[model samples]
Target: MKRSTLYKDELIVQIMGMTDKLQRRFQSEGVDEERSWMLQQTDNPAVISFLKRATMMMLHVIDAIVALEPVNGIRIASHLGIPRGSVSKITRKLVQEHVIQMEYLPDNKKKIMFRTTSLGKEVSKVHLALHRHVNMNVHALLNRYTPEQLAFLAQVQSDILNTSLVKEDLASIKDDPPPAAENPPEAMDMRQAAQEDPIRDLLDMLHQLDSANLSKAKDLLQVVFFAGHNG
Candidate 1:
């Protein structure tokens, strides 16, 4: 076999191994560990119990309500790229947990809206802090790569998503809607894609970095990548 073909096969094996490791690392055990870490950050029993009971989807719903109070279910569904029915179910649980409360506008009594209660605000605060902690670590790691390297990584991720297998899966989903929900299969595919893609989130954060931070990041990357290469 050609050396180039051998190298390509090895690279594919390495990539697949890394993907499998990442998948395992973020499975249920990883989630429970993160949830435990978040739980330790607060003393309130209600918040503790709520955190214990809440799924990631439930936490996201509360976070959305905290960020966009007086927002209705449909808007939350759209904002989160989830089904309205799923949002409805999550909000009902949130209300039951007393993390969020239902409200009706005086002008439109028929349209129900959601707002976080004091408990919910506390929960949101903790969740935000947890994310900030995670982001800080991720940012520190990513700062080790130059902007060019980051862009290359993004392109690789995009390529993976655009592969024929993923495209076929998406196409099939559009034709065969799930039996449990009335939502269009296309919307479901989009939601699943959004959940699976951290590259998009990373790109957004990179774009949002202030000039001072961006310069600092570039300097760090130069030291980490360029300095090593030149040596």
Candidate 2:
């Protein structure tokens, strides 16, 4: 095999191993707390949605402050490439939820600005902690590899992340689901099964989409053409 091809395979193995080790360590060290947190999010739709809203709010706040100087809902939505109505919905909900505080500009009654609350900051800390802990755990496991191996793994991960974005960007062009084959037995069975167990069907659809995305990504990254024609 080519040197680069071999190196990529080694990196994939290291990443898989690192992931396995982190999962095991989590189970061993903080299983109870982890389980509790997972259950809390899983059981409470409000809490889960709050986390999602909090993250969007934090990013909007950061981006608005950086780009627009002083940001209101309109500016936040513009920066995020979302609709103003949606931004208003999220901001109003966040304000009512007390995760953010709004301030009106003195010159204009209609103009408003936002700042994170203490509660919001606390949630941000938890979000950051989760990111750091997971990354550190994975990196610690990866440290067994040599510096060269680590560099190769990092490059491979970077490529994968980029390809994932490409896949998502391409997927966004779709307006509707693909049509199923009519009167097919496999389709009938799948339809019946999906009707019986919607959640499982949804999961299987996601898995299939994920596989397609990765397959498309692999095809995108591979270099192949008729030798004389392209060259």
> Which candidate number would show the highest lDDT if scored against the true structure?
1
lDDT of 1 by residue, 112-165 (tens): 999999999999999999899989999999999855456557656665665676
TM-score of each: 0.68, 0.39
- Model 1 TM-score? 0.68
lDDT of 2 by residue, 203-226 (tens): 665576676786765565454534
Query: How accurate locally is residue 149 in candidate 1, as Cα lDDT from 0 to 100?
Result: 54
Q: Name the regions of candidate 1 deviating beyond 4 angstroms.
A: 168-231
Model 1: how far is 100 from its true place, Å? 0.7
Q: Please tell me which predicted candidate would have the highest TM-score against the true structure.
A: 1
After superposition, the stretches of candidate 2 with alpha carbons farther than 4 Å from their true spots are 1-70, 74-86, 161-231
Worst 10 residues of 1 by lDDT: 174-183
